[model samples]
Target: MIQQFRRFCAGLIVSLSAFGGFAGAAENADLLLSGPLFPAIETFHLENGMQVGVVPDARATFVTHMVWYRVGAADEASGKSGIAHFLEHLLFKGTEKFPGNAIDRTVKAVGGNHNAFTSHDYTGYFQKVTREHLPLMMEIEADRMMNVDFNAADVDVERQVVLEERARGIETSPRAQLSAAMDLALFKNHPYRRPIIGWRNEIESLNVDEIREFYERFYTPANAILIVAGNVTLDEVKSLAGKVYAPLQNRAPAYQPERPQEPDELRMRQVITVRDPKITNESITITFRVPSFRTGLPGENEAIDMLSEILSGTTRSRIYRDMVIDRQIATSAGAYAGSGARDDTTFALYATPKGEVTLEEMEKELFAAIDRIARDGVTSDELDRARKRLFANAIYAQDSASGLANILGRTLIVGNRLEDIRSWPDRLRAITPAQIQAVAAKFFDPDKAVIGLLRRPIDFETASLKKDPA
Candidate 1:
């Protein structure tokens, strides 16, 4: 009996190992050597000059219709910050063919979901629904693309909504407020300094005419890409797109000049204090300019990504282990590289210092970690873990229909091929520890960083009164 049990245990171990190996192989298979594993997208140009991309996936019963416009907050003029995001909200208010709430009602009745967002480089609208609702989704999206009704009353309503959103997303959160301030102080000539939701004053002052003009100028077929995925054939998508978007006349694309580079940081530190009754603790955010996705060298970009992961990629990361868990100086600490399409981007180190631990102490430890990485470089074990985590995330990203749409749309907007997305992991895997250290030494210079602090306000009035008006 003992001999039989041992044999069975050995067989079970072999079976489990085989299963694990097969699973790893399946995940790695999606990491294409040359391009994405997805079916070759059938591209078409409609009569109205709108570009269409179709990827047919018949495994699921649902479909995703996405419209991507080659405009974002970066397209906003000096004073027109947040107009792109504001306009995103206005598109849903109403249109000539369909009144306000008509599209929402139709989508809800069909058990579908719809939403849109604006970024630094693009704006997009998308819908997920049963295959039979493809034509309806396309028709409604096309109608709003060119025929949106930006009436005065609707503008007023959405303006308030956006303001409330800003208050929640920016005003109430010290971290977000500090981030906004850092951007404003960091970029003097670039539109990237402008907030995506626009400033409170700008949103309040934006009128109906400005909104309408922005719509007419940017929301055209020539400046847009339509992507349809899941539960549909290329022919069906093309036919539906032709009937819906082909009638709208195309306009010439809008043009914007390249943003100028930011000057060298002149100060070692800057502080911003916001006194709110609801506030509890102090926070610090450090930002440095790095090569953007558009112009970064192949190795440089990968190293930057790896550097971010090594410092703040997970709870086991250096910052979390040293500052938060071991020293107990900070509640949280991490680093991140902002994902953008420009030629220059920002890398940030943010932390919320704990009680009795000044922001300066937290900053010291954070920089120490960066300095150590620059001097000694990351270990092979660290590199292997980072690569494995990144690979897992890549596979997980493919599972979301909307996420896939956004990835493809954003990449195309930035003038990159879909293959670049698929080949990212192999590129990441090839990065050496020496390259990662070199990138840190090159870009993460303390003198080149913008440090902003949010703290409790001092009681100046009470202090002055106590000093006999001195």
Candidate 2:
């Protein structure tokens, strides 16, 4: 994973340098258009009710084909926490027409790769191959749209795999445990409180029938979006998609009510102690509820994003500069704002204090930085630097076929148009210093934040002889 991440970062840096020259022009165009700086995408709906979006970039011979299902862990019914994720795993097991290892064998034979991921708002499966294989990839994805074969034995095997994943991801890590607890404490009735991997007992008890039911309900053409990007013309993609995906009939969209709003946090703090011999360090996480990408108005979401960047987008960010570098109180510190499809979101700060530097000291500095931003607002220079970093990162993302597919699918799934994906660099460039400050002041309130600490257990001695004499 670390190697993969390093490769990804390296590739991003190269792409950013190459694309930097286009930033000024893109920003100017965005200002004139009132939204994105790029031309509109060619979007059309198939007779089967599938929405297809094409962004014809003929820069390379590679094409990215993605099928995005508009249901994720958030759409799981009560007592069905991990069904969505389980279905994601099962899709690769087999299908009616392709059966067994057909997808893997064929993709590899054609010099292509395929994968999928499940999030709170959506699940996506994609493949990247040469333009010549676009039609074959599309047909393979469409074949498994609703033709997955789920057996009881397969369910049992995958369930254990998920359990092991949870153990590695949450159970064994103190930080992960604290994060899960914080999420539960943060939301009272929202499904976001449930982990995307689902609870252990819930996952263990889930059967084949439940998984199949979820697939039938949410994996319909109407609830899915098809994105094809690469060295292909819009007309070619449309014609191929019509032939491949138009056969599936539509189904009624899933209907769910709005997520219940979380009440204002009067005062909440949690301290979790883990007893593991291997544990030698402690960490802290502070989370603040903010607006989701979908709920906020145009540019509103960007403002919060800019605020997060200003706080701890990089080593030069305020938190890192103050706590990690200047004072040397923390080993590492950073901030994150989750851009998802819900109305409410979280802005989190994660830190690992230096030895003998108490979590209290770390929390003090973290809150102080946020308070300063809320009071004085960020400077124009700080905001501009953050914006430039984001723009650079966005440009860097254009190199990877998988990254492009993810960006398009995620933005569209969250209710934004596909055009927003191309114009994101321009939008990041246009955010003003004052706008970042305004959002910081509104959403960075201490009262709305949840502070959690993970630490080793404290030792205590108890009386013995004195009590016996009494």
Candidate 3:
């Protein structure tokens, strides 16, 4: 169970693919995507209000289909922290029409791949199969959407599975523990602080009634988006969707995402330290709250994305070159701007010290590097290299049709339009070296930071990491 969960989080599937463009915008998506007509983007809505998006790639004979539900960790009821995730597992358990492993058996027999995933803002199920099997994929997905069997025994069985997942994924690892602690300190009132996997106590206590209510509420047509990418046309997709999905009623409950609002995080330097016997390398991570794609201006997301690359994206990155190669204070150092977020996001910088180098020394050196970037700013050469690399990767990403499908699914799910997904390169290209430095100085404030340490228990004993805090 632990091994399975580790692999899941390690790749950390974020369907918010951030990949290629919509082949052509559907007529309905033109108003929603809100821009000039794009070449291959096709978007529409079913009679029942389920938004459908198509990205045609004649290059391949296979297709990737995704159904995204607008419910995730942030949408669960207060005491039922893991219900959204639990439902993701249970949804696969069966429905009356596709009873008892039928979905899995059929997919395996067809030589297709299928999986589901959950994140802070949404849960999604997807299947990839040859173009000829697209309708069959739709039939099964559409059937399960309306007829999921929320059996009591299934709930109890999956509850234990989630507990095992949490234990293996979070409880045993020092880094995972540190990351969870950092989340708790980062968001004040937002449900983003809660682990998408849910706490063990909450997972154990969640019952069938809560799961059923959640399923009936957030899994409706109005709350779902269907994304198809491959050798197919908008017209064929519409016809198929009309037959398969249009039957599901577009019922809007009184539920609008009533998530808690997070207050301004004004505190300077919150800290969480975890001591575990299994921990080998002592590490420190610094997280700063930043604007998400949904809130930031067009250029802001691109600027920060470039900023992460310029800071610590490669061996040539400033932090890596300075600390790992020149100064020899750490073995590795990297910076990242969190992606696929609906609300606010965090910018993270992490490093692990080399032998005989104290974590204190590593911390001082790491901060000095960030402070230098904030103070003097970065040069055009560094900026150009980072920008070129980002664009190059974006171009490379377009090769995979399924990859592009994943991107479209994530973009639409996160309250973003298809136009911007198509225009991602222009935005990244427009980001200036000054803008990168500006976001650096603006977001990397020492006062608005959460510092977390994952250290060996012996080191904690010698140092001052005395007590564990809630």
Q: TM-score for all predictions?
A: 0.85, 0.86, 0.89
What TM-score number comes out for model 1?
A: 0.85
* 1 versus 2: better lDDT goes to: 1
Find the candidate with the highest TM-score and give its number.
3
Cα error, residue 410 of model 3, in Å, equals 1.0
Better of 1 and 3 by lDDT: 3
Off by over 4 Å in 2: 1-41, 254-257, 265-275, 422-430, 459-470
Candidate order, lDDT descending:
3, 1, 2
Candidate 2 worst ten-residue window by lDDT:
1-10
Candidates in order: C-alpha RMSD to true structure = 10.2, 5.3, 6.4
| Cα lDDT for residue 339, candidate 1 | 41
Question: What's model 2's overall lDDT?
Answer: 0.71
User: What lDDT score is found at residue 45 in candidate 2?
Assistant: 86
Ranking by TM-score: 3, 2, 1
Name the regions of candidate 3 deviating beyond 4 angstroms. 1-39, 253-258, 459-470
Which pairs clash in the backbone of model 1?
Answer: none
Q: Give the TM-score of candidate 2.
A: 0.86
Candidate 1 residue spans exceeding 4 A from truth: 1-49, 254-257, 264-269, 459-470
Instruction: Specify the poorest-scoring 10-residue window by lDDT in model 3.
Output: 1-10
Per-residue C-alpha lDDT of model 1 across residues 221-307, encoded as one tens digit per residue: 978889888878888877788788888886656444366666654434455555555557777778877775566777787777778
